[model samples]
Target: MHQLVATPFGGRGLILRPGSTKAVQLPLARFEELRALASALSTVPQWLIGPVRAQWNVDLTSRSVGDAILVREAGPYEFSRATWEINLGCDLDCSICYLGEKKFEGLDMDGKRKLLAVMRDAGVIWLQITGGEPLIDRDFPESYQIAHEMGMLLELLSNGSRLRKPHILNLLRTFPPAKLTLSVYGATAETYDTVTRRRGGFDRFREGLEQAVDAGLNIDLSLIIVQENAHEVEAMRDWARQLGVPYREYANISPTIHGTAEPLPSQSPQYLTNRAPFTGCPAGVTFFHADPFGRASICKVGREPNIDLIAEGVEGLTRLGGIAESLMLRTGGCSGCKLSDSCRVCRPMAKVFQEAKAPLVNYCQHGMR
Candidate 1:
């Protein structure tokens, strides 16, 4: 497992450690020095070592410099981040899951390896490994290990269903993610199980969270507020606070990637949170999302025009910038709206809501206000 990573991103150098969000800026001179000592585990001078230890308590004493400390050369692609959905298969069947069908399908081990290589070569410095539940995938461990080996900072998104398992816990302990985010449906068993529509789900979730916390893994909680569990939102917030991990609340539910309205009924309209106005986003420009089959899209929410990274390879990404611009054009149902300047949702999101025939209040400022 790599203890620390040193890489160039966005015209600057960064030194990052596993299981920690703190990053140390690597000077051009020091960064080039490590690049020169490519084959040898040379001694790290005190000038550089002192601050790293202070920030993350990582000692460079016995660790290999050239090997343990992964040093990656800057790549041609300007992309510094990506999100990959390993598989849509999830353990629980939640009523409001954005991934409507939650089908269990994806690439084989070889294809997955190829996709990760493409991400690395494209300069994806920060990667989020997610799924309906990524832990359930058989190839997840190896895929994660491979990405970590290639010097990408990893973050995981899961439902906390399998975090208690010895195998999953041990794997995480060995090669820690920079952050692990889990979705919290409710604070108690009855509300939790009702929302998930699965028996004993709350018990399993609590156990998993306990084990993960005990293992000292970096964790973030996502408080999911839906109609089934809306009454328990405060209880959920209190539980997350007591657990002492960082958390954020989400009340807005959306249509599926295919623009279906199945998940809309699960939303609690009265409990919805206010949304900020839509602004320009750097989706295809700086970051992209890869689905299970390795098709790269501008982002998860904007999926229509995508690149087949598997068939065309990294060079195909060049077309995405134009695709993003075309997709962002406000010429659909939103074309001449007087409030288009302050609309809360982006074009891709509004298009899906329109497809789902959702109530305008859900996304349009005209109805909402």
Candidate 2:
């Protein structure tokens, strides 16, 4: 096991071992300083240096400690983080689900364990367990425990409906995720129910949030901006503030994983129209996603399977680097467009539009301009 684990927030911290109970928090800079001092001293015990050297893949003789730990570059086949879609069986039929009305089929417990092992061996440090609703997965408790035992920093992304259940709450208390991100659809029952189209979703969400807080779990609230819930955005923020929980707003909506624009209608047009320069995408490079069936892709939005992780294993991930490189290159009409300067459009979506020539009016705001 690695002596120093990377936190989800991008800092390095020590997880005390040898029958230890908890992680010891440390700042990145300070951890680096200790590592440097330890590396320089020949008198330091081998037991102390062994784990750090193995974890960072340090060459003590040739490379400086600063150089070794400063930047972590992933090899072609390696990934730092992975998002595993445990199941697609969400209880609430929200107006803006990226997967739309997808059928839910997940790996059996044994298969799931194998997949987790593959990810761990492939060097995934942070594993995000997401779903239509992760807590609803019948095998979630065992799966969560297995991942935790494998030394992966886990993040649970859920609608927070089932989290109110005693069994689920107990599971969280026993092996807490590094972070629990709950999706808040609206500020009140009326607005939330309107978006979810489920009668008691808001109540269940509230109850779940309370249960998680009572369990002393780290919680983050994410508000999805859509036509039904846009009016209550500020109120939702205020509610998160009142609860003293960190909150963020997601205004951008993407097409379904199947390449259909089902959720596009629910998106706020004003939000789509606002443009920014195209920064780089991290998909297939530092991050990857695996669907319920173990098909791997660069991201959720770009669900063109680059590999079948269940069949190919780590070798398949190497092919993703070339795929990622190709996806980043400009395609079709995007190559010489005047609006390219301020385009916020991503390459995958651009490729979709280019091939179809379908005027995704909201997505192609620059075209209208």
Candidate 3:
């Protein structure tokens, strides 16, 4: 695994690395040279070490380009980011989970390794490993390590249930992710446990979150503002500020991916925030989501006609852009609706809510206004 990486992003040259937030912009000429050297497995010129040092505060221990730097080859695909659901399993039973069902099933180790390889070839620069709590996946450690080695800037989405484990901590320290996001169900144990329906869930979450903070990992907090935990929203924000970690609030809870309204009952009416108006998105164009079984979709909410990556491999991804167009263009109940100019939810999300027979006010502008 290379210690540094040089790749093209949005027509610009970027130099980044694992375990650090700093990135250096490279001139096109220099970026091409580095990319060539990486492809050739050649030694890096003596000059690169100086800039790397100045930018990232690290000294290259090796001169070999393949060892000290991973020059990402420009791929035919335009994808720059992706999120994989390692597994749908979870140790907690949060009432507001969007995945709908939490089955502990996904690609096996060999299949997982293949999937990561495909992502690297497809030009994924930023990869988010999410789940019903990804850290609890049996293959997460090894899969995470392999992805880091392959030069994708990794991000993790979890519930802070397993971050305190020594092996997990050591693995993270060794190949740190670009960001580690944990969702705060509640600030107090009683409310938190009640939200998760898991005894001792709050204590475990606190333990793991504190350990992550102590490790100096790049951390973010997702304050889940649902009915069960809305009372603790302020306390959660204060705690996050006290810890000095970045925090964002997600006050909207929608129907599950399966188009089930089971999770909507937990929505806190007073806490519901207005969503920005529906606009264009780049879901299948530059980004996509992969479920536990390696079914690729434009996004989590639009799972139909998914490509089975394990069976068809990376070549199957070529059809996704067209699929994106087909799905995004179908406005469902909002088709030709004059209120669409003010509607916040997108076509896929609107479809899910419609399938669940959700109250119009929950997602439609007609009721919202």
Candidate 4:
């Protein structure tokens, strides 16, 4: 579907499909003008806007064209959303966590505030507050409040262990987030505790969900399917449905932030094999990730920092445009691979191959042989 996205260089990008390789870039003023014109002719059929569609290779007959034309326009900053890992300290130890056991010395309260301000100024309307467990951070309330006061839609990613706490619930009541996404380990306490390797995790998770729902908070649940909990997939979905809450399922498990494939052992090979071809990654194009220390990159897997929010401020974002462009160009072993259409190998993972010559057996079904 056609949609307006963010460019690495703090500009606008148009994606013809959600993960399609075809896209176009436009400056903020031009994008704004196009959106305005699209809104003015909202009732007209998209096919009638052939001239506009042709400019960006948009499918004229696609139903999403009109909706995309009048998309949420990013302000001067260009990026619509930002995922910030507020901290790396967690209460539970999940064997399949992408971050692994790497200790992160996050920014202080003032440093975090500066990073938030930079993100807000960049026109990021949606800020995802995540962490090893964001609720554990003493500065989480203040940082969350700052984003909320700035009128940014905030989404919290958590394990749901602390949501039952009186202070945590009080903070949420004061400034409710747009949504809270909790990761469900398993359907039963036995399986859940086995996956998380923590006693009483399932009980705490249930309590947290109950608290959030009772407080009238929107909640979304996700299951990261692994060998440890694959058998409980159906049961987990049924449980979520019974709660009348939305749920999603994920099968692919990538390496840790330190580029270690420790989580691969838990991944379901069949699930990884069923993925579609590598269309493109919206990393430098429409998405970005920032670690706890204020280092921003194109994506979480692509750890090469394009900007240091605390040290360089918003000006650092300007360097991302070139990085994004460079990433778009196929290079290394992927430059002329014949399996491009059916290959699930993404650029960041491919970079790992090119640099370390390590085969991501779990990520690539074909074994990259």
Best by lDDT: 1
- What RMSD does each model have against the real structure? 1.4, 7.5, 1.8, 9.3
TM-score of each: 0.96, 0.78, 0.95, 0.76
* Candidate 3 C-alpha lDDT tens digits along 1-369: 678878888777888988666798877888888777777877777677888888877787467887788778776789989999999999998877887778898789999998898888889989999998899988999999999988899999999889889999889988989999899989999999999999998999999999999999999999998888887889999999999999999988989988999999999999887788988788999998998888899998888879988888778899999888998765667778877666788889999999889998898768855
Error of 2 at 215 (Å): 2.0
Task: Report the candidate with higher lDDT, 1 versus 2.
Answer: 1
Off by over 4 Å in 4: 1-75, 270-273, 352-361, 365-369
- Per-residue lDDT value at 127 in model 2: 84
Candidate 4's TM-score reads: 0.76
lDDT of 4 by residue, 312-354 (tens): 8877877776676676566766777666677776777667544
Root-mean-square deviation of Cα positions for candidate 2 versus the true structure, in angstroms: 7.5
What lDDT score belongs to each candidate, Candidate 1 first?
A: 0.88, 0.73, 0.87, 0.73
CA RMSD (A), model 3: 1.8
- In the range 263-338, model 1's lDDT, one tens digit per residue, is 8998888878667998788899889999999999999989988999999898988888999999998877888788
lDDT of 2 at 268: 77
**202-255: candidate 2 lDDT, tens digit per residue:** 999999898788777889999888888888888999999988899988877766
Worst 10 residues of 1 by lDDT: 37-46
